[model samples]
Target: MSVEGNPGRRLLDEDRLFSSDPSQRSVARRLYAEIRDLPIVSPHGHTDPRWFADNEAFENPAKLFVTPDHYVFRMLYSQGIPLESLGVARRDGGPVESDPRKVWRLLAENYGLFRGTPSRLWLDHALSEVFGVQERLSAANADAVYDQVQACLDKPEYRPRALFDRFKIEVIATTESPLDPLESHARVRDSDWDGRVITAYRPDPVVDPEYEDFTANLEQLAEMTGETTSGWKGYLAALQQRRGFFAEMGATSTDHGHPSAATADLDPAACQSLLDRALSGAITAEDAELFRAQMLTEMARMSLEDGLVMQIHPGSFRSHNQKLMAGFGRDMGADIPTRTDYVRALRPLLSRFGNEPGLDVILFTLDETSYSRELAPLAGHYPILKLGPAWWFYDSPEGMLRYRRSVTETAGFYNTVGFNDDTRAFLSIPARHDVARRIDCAYLAELVCDHRLDEDEALEVAVDLTYNLVKKAYRL
Candidate 1:
C-alpha cells in the first residue's frame, strides 16, 4: 500500500458547502471556523456498541464502507448491482461475495453511481480526512485506495476507541432493543477507556406486534425480566425493568422507528384485550398499528417517570422489497418513505402530555413535507416536543438546506435538537457531522447576507446548532 495518487489532485474543496457570493462565503467561513472543532454529540444512531467494547481493528475497506452502509449498497443495488456481490449476507446462510477486495473493486468500478449523492460526499470525506488518501476512488485506484485504508485499519490508532477520541466525540448513543443485554455498553462503562458510548432503548421488537419473531421476543423479555407477557400490566412492568437496566448502563433516551407518528391512549381493559390478541396471533394490521400507537403514549408516560428522552422517527415503509427482505432480512435499504400525518396521528398522546415540561419527545420524519406544515407548528406550540434534524433520506447537502429553509420560520432554532449522524457506518460519523456543521453555517450566512439575522447572532446560533441544542434536547 502506498500514498501514490494523482499529482496535484485533492478530493475535497476547502470551501465546499459555502455560498458562491464573496460576502456570504466570508460569513459562512467565519461561522464554520467558530464551531468546526466542536465535539460531536451523536444522541441517536445505529452504530454497534461492540466496536468500542471489543476495541478491535476494522476488517477491511469493503466491510468498513460498502457492506455495512445501506447508503452505499442501496445506491449500487438501485443500478442493478446484486447485493450478494457487495457482501450483504443471505438469511439462509447462503454464499455471497467473501473477498473484501473484490467487493471494494465493484464499488470502485461503479463509483460514479454515487456521484452527486451524499454517499459520495461521506465516502470521500472519510477517505481523505480520516485516512489521508488524497486521490479520488476509481476502478483504476480501487486497489490502491483499498490497501491504503486497510493499512490504516491495521494500526492501533485506527482502533474504534482511539478513533472515537480522535473524532472528538463528546458522547454517542447506540440504539438497542429491550431484549438486548447491553453487555457491550456495560463493557464500555466498566473499562478504563474514557470514551463515552451509551445505549438508547429501542423496543420495536417487543412493542410492535407485527415485528419478526414478535411473540418469541416477548417471551425472551419475560425470561430476562421475570415478568409474564400474558397480562398487559406484567408486560409493562417488564419493559420498565429493561428501561431501568438500560438507564443504569447510561442510556439517556429511547428510540422508536414506527411506520407513522400515530399514538393512542387506550384504557387498561382495552390494552389487556389488545395484548391478548397480539400474543394469540390474531392481531390485525389495524390493531398492530394501534398497539404500536398506544405504546408511543405509554413510552412517553414512562419517559416522564424515568427522565429518558423519547424519540420517534415515523413514516418509513420499512422492508419494502419482500424478495430482498426474504433473502437478506430487514434494513437492507428496501425502505421507502411514505407520507406521514402527525397532527392527527399524535393527538391521542399530545392531548394527554402535550403540556408537560418534564417530558421531552424528539420527532423526526422521512417525509420532508412535514417539516414546515406539521412538525414545526407542533414543536412550536408544544412544551414537551422538539424537532429533530433532517433525518434518514434527507441527510444530504441539498436536503439539509431544504430542512433549514422549511423549519426555521415556524419552529425557530431552540425548538429543535441539533445534528446526529444516525449512521451504522462508524467512520462516517465525523464526515456526517462536518456536513451538518457546514450546512448550518451556510444557512446562517444566508440569513445574515439577507439582513434577516445579525452576523454576531448567527455565529452564536451556529455554535448552539452544532453543540448546545443537541446536549440540551437529548439531555446528553
Candidate 2:
C-alpha cells in the first residue's frame, strides 16, 4: 500500500538524472526548468495514427502499457514469462491471456526485472506523474493502480487526442508503408481535432527483397498507381507516385529500416537486371542486399525532387530469435544490434548526393561504436548527412549521454538532430521526452561548469536541443 519501506519513499526524485556535484546539479535544475515544458517536436515515431484520428479511449492499463510496447513485453519475456501471458497475440490467432488484470499483476510482480532500465524510469514516471499513482507498482497494488488508470481512461480528458494536446506535441509523424491507403491520416487531417498527425513514407515492403510478399507488394504498388511495376522505369514511377500520394496526405519524410547501411549506384541496365531478379523471387541473399542498397540511392534522388526528409535506420539483425519471430511475427523485441559500417557503407550514396544541398538524410544506428569513429565525422563533413538521436536500444539516459559525448565534439550540435521518441507506446512519449530533456540539461550543465560554454549559450543550446533542432531538421 505504501512506498515508505521501499529503497526510495518518493517514486521519482526531483533531482533525478542530474550531475553529482551540487553546483552542476543546480545548473542542470535551472536549465531543465527553462525547457522542460517546451513543445515536443516528434518528427519521427511509431504511434498509431488511428488513435488520434478516432479519439478513442485506450481499453485498459495492460493494453496501454504491456501489450503495445516491445520494451515492456520483451523484458518480461526475457524473464521466462510467455508473451501470450502478457496478452501479446500470436500470428496464428492462438489463445493468449485476455484478462487485463492478470497481465498487469504479472508485470507488477516482475517490475524488478526493469530495476535499472529506461523502462523502469518511464513506467514509474507514467504511473506517478501521468496517472497520479504515487505508490510503487507491486503485486499488492497492481489491481488498485490498474483500476485507477482504467478510470482515467474512461474520462473524456484522457482520450488519445486529448492526451496528444495535453502533451503539447507540436507535430508527430507516424510511419506507414507504401501500400497503406493512409485513410487514418486523412481522417486526422479532415477532423476538427487540430492535432497535427502526419505520416512518413516507409517503402520497405516494395524496396526490400527479403520482405515477405515482396512481389505481391510490387503488384499492389502497380495497382495503387497505374504503372507497370514489372519494368524498372515503371517501378520507379510507381514509387515516385506513392511518395507524392504520401506527401499529399501530410507526409514530410521517408524512413528505411534496412539490415545494413549499404548503398550502391549501379548503371541503369544493371539496375534493371537486379529488379528482374528481385521480381522473379530467384535472387540470393546478397542480391537482395544489393538491390536494397541501390534503392537507398534512388530514394535519395527522389527526396531531392519531393523534398521529403530521409531517415536510414540500419545495423539491426532483425528477428534474431527465430522462434519468437516464427511465433509472434516481427518487432517483438528479437532485433539485436550488430556491427555496422557507415563510412564505407554510405560512401556510394554520399558520393552521389553528398554535395546536394537540397537533400536532408538522417542516419540512425544501433551500433554505438560507429558514433564517434564514423557517423560523427561523416555527418560533420557532408551537407546531406545529419545524425539521428540515440535510437531503439539506445534511447536511454546513459545512451543519450554517450551519444552527446561521442558526436558533439566532432559534428557539433547543428550536425545532430534533436530527440525523437521513436516509440509505439503513446503514454511513454512524454516520459521519454522528459528523460531526454533532463539528460541534455545535465550535459549542458557539465559543459558550463567546465567553462567550455557560457550559461547564456548553454541555455540557448538547451532550447535548440529540446525543441528547435528537431523542427529544423525534420522541416516540421
- Which stretches of model 1 miss by more than 4 angstroms? 1-8
Residue 304 displacement (Å), model 1: 0.6
lDDT of 2 by residue, 91-128 (tens): 99999999999999999999889988999999999888
lDDT of 1 by residue, 1-476 (tens): 24556657677898998999999999999999999999999998999999999999998999899899999999999999999999989999999999999999999999998889888999999999999998878898888888889999999999999999999999999999999998998888899999999999999999999999999999999999999988999999999999999999999999999999999999999999999999999999999999999999999999999999999989999999999999999999999999999999999999999999899999999988888999999999999999988898899999999999998899999998989889999999999999999999999999999999999999989999999999999887
- Alpha-carbon TM-score of each model against the true structure: 0.99, 0.98
What does candidate 2 score on TM?
A: 0.98
Q: Worst lDDT window (10 residues) for model 2?
A: 1-10
Off by over 4 Å in 2: 2-10
Local distance difference test, each candidate = 0.93, 0.93
